[model samples]
Target: MFDVAPTELLLVAVVALLVIGPKDLPRAMHFVGKWVGKARGVARQFRSGMDTMIREAELAEMEKQWAAENERIMREHPPAPSLSAPEAESADGADMHDLPPLMVAQPDIRPEPVAAEAPVSEVEEPKTRGQGEHPL
Candidate 1:
């Protein structure tokens, strides 16, 4: 994270060894590593929380769009009327059988015959370029 090259890190280590001494250098390095690891863990947790919130927001928007489309479809094609109990059954408790029959008509289609082409006649010999024009 500090962008330290190998040579620069070596220089820093030598200085740290002279200042902090060899005995306490390992303990100080260990403590710093622990703090860096904790900072990374917190950053990872925050990133995951933001990702979860973004996903939930996207899902909520999709659900709203779906609901709007469903409502539009329902408005476009309303439900068919239901027959009442009295209308479905006759007075003597018999079922009614008076539904009208449906009629569908289809047009007849036929292919027409193709006409035969006439034979081509042979062409006569062509005249020279100067035959039909006057000299300039």
Candidate 2:
């Protein structure tokens, strides 16, 4: 983000060398490097925390949308009335025994047995080039 050109960087380095002096420049640079590393670490942590918060917010928003949609759908299509034993009897004036069984008889649908296949014959190996034969 800091638009530092090569010339600008060279100028800064020359000024630092002159101000800090060559004898203590190495130590000063090391100290600056350590602080830069720490700053970068903090920035990375902050970015990750922001990302996590954003993702959580998105998830919560999606959940709310889903709930609203579910409510809308439920309102649009009401549930059908369930037929309890008493309700069924009162409505039709018929006993439970008079009703047909829930499950109907299914026809046997097993597959037919397949006939055994003929055994395959063994193949003969071709002669190699070394056995008085020319290679193709």
Candidate 3:
């Protein structure tokens, strides 16, 4: 599982035989294999524990940030000043029926000056040459 190919394993076995002698090499190899397995298991357990702790920390941080953001939003835009419908609806909203009388503007009914007229034409029709003569 260490990703060591067959050639690498053979090389390690040869080295172990040379270093520890053929008589003791088998015992050394057995102990070494067990130790590697234990090391891998410990590593996996540690990595999983770290992953769990990190996720928990991230969740807690997000919750805190959300709480802070909500508090800020509330401070920025407190509930609008409440008024009765008759007091709040102005004539500016044409669709509103319960508008307050005080919101209406006074109408200006003064007469405006009339617009000037352009000169009129007396002729009823204009004349044109016939195209049957020739192409110019």
Candidate 4:
């Protein structure tokens, strides 16, 4: 990280040995190593956090752009004709009911056919319950 060549590093080490003394040099080196490791760990954590923040910001920007594009596209190409029937027509003596069945728009849903009901005499009816009374 310091961009110091091997010769420069050796020179620094020699200077450190003279200043710090040969006796405590190893201990000092060990302490420096620990501090460097901690610094690297903190720097790594900071970098990861910044990356996460950047990703979130990018995602938000993309979403905004997407929404704007969607709006533009919708405006450019309006929706197809509405499926609902119009409220009224101005033609004289022309009733809406007079239109042929095929000409009128039919609902997409088809109703279920009702089952044939059994004869009242053939089916036993449940007895009616009185006020607060259970039907047995």
- Candidate order by lDDT, decreasing, is 2, 4, 1, 3
TM-score: which candidate is best?
A: 2
Candidate 3 at residue 136, lDDT? 61
Query: Model 1 over residues 1-136: C-alpha lDDT tens digits?
Result: 5787999989988999999999999999999899999999999999999999999999999999999999999999998888665557658776566646557787888889888988888987976678877766
Give the better candidate number (1 or 2) by TM-score: 2
Clashing pairs in 2: none
Across residues 3-81, which tens digit of lDDT does each residue of candidate 2 receive? 9999999999999999999999999999999999999999999999999999999999999999999999999998889
Order of candidate numbers by TM-score, starting with the best: 2, 4, 1, 3
- Please state the error at residue 51 of candidate 2 in Å: 0.7
Global lDDT for candidate 4? 0.90
In order, the Cα lDDT scores of the candidates are 0.89, 0.92, 0.85, 0.90
lDDT head-to-head 1 vs 2, winner: 2
Error of 2 at 112 (Å): 25
Clash count, one per candidate: 0, 0, 0, 0
Q: Per-residue lDDT tens digits of candidate 3, residues 60-117?
A: 9999999999999999999888876663344576645564444677798989989889
TM-score of each: 0.54, 0.62, 0.44, 0.56
Off by over 4 Å in 4: 81-136
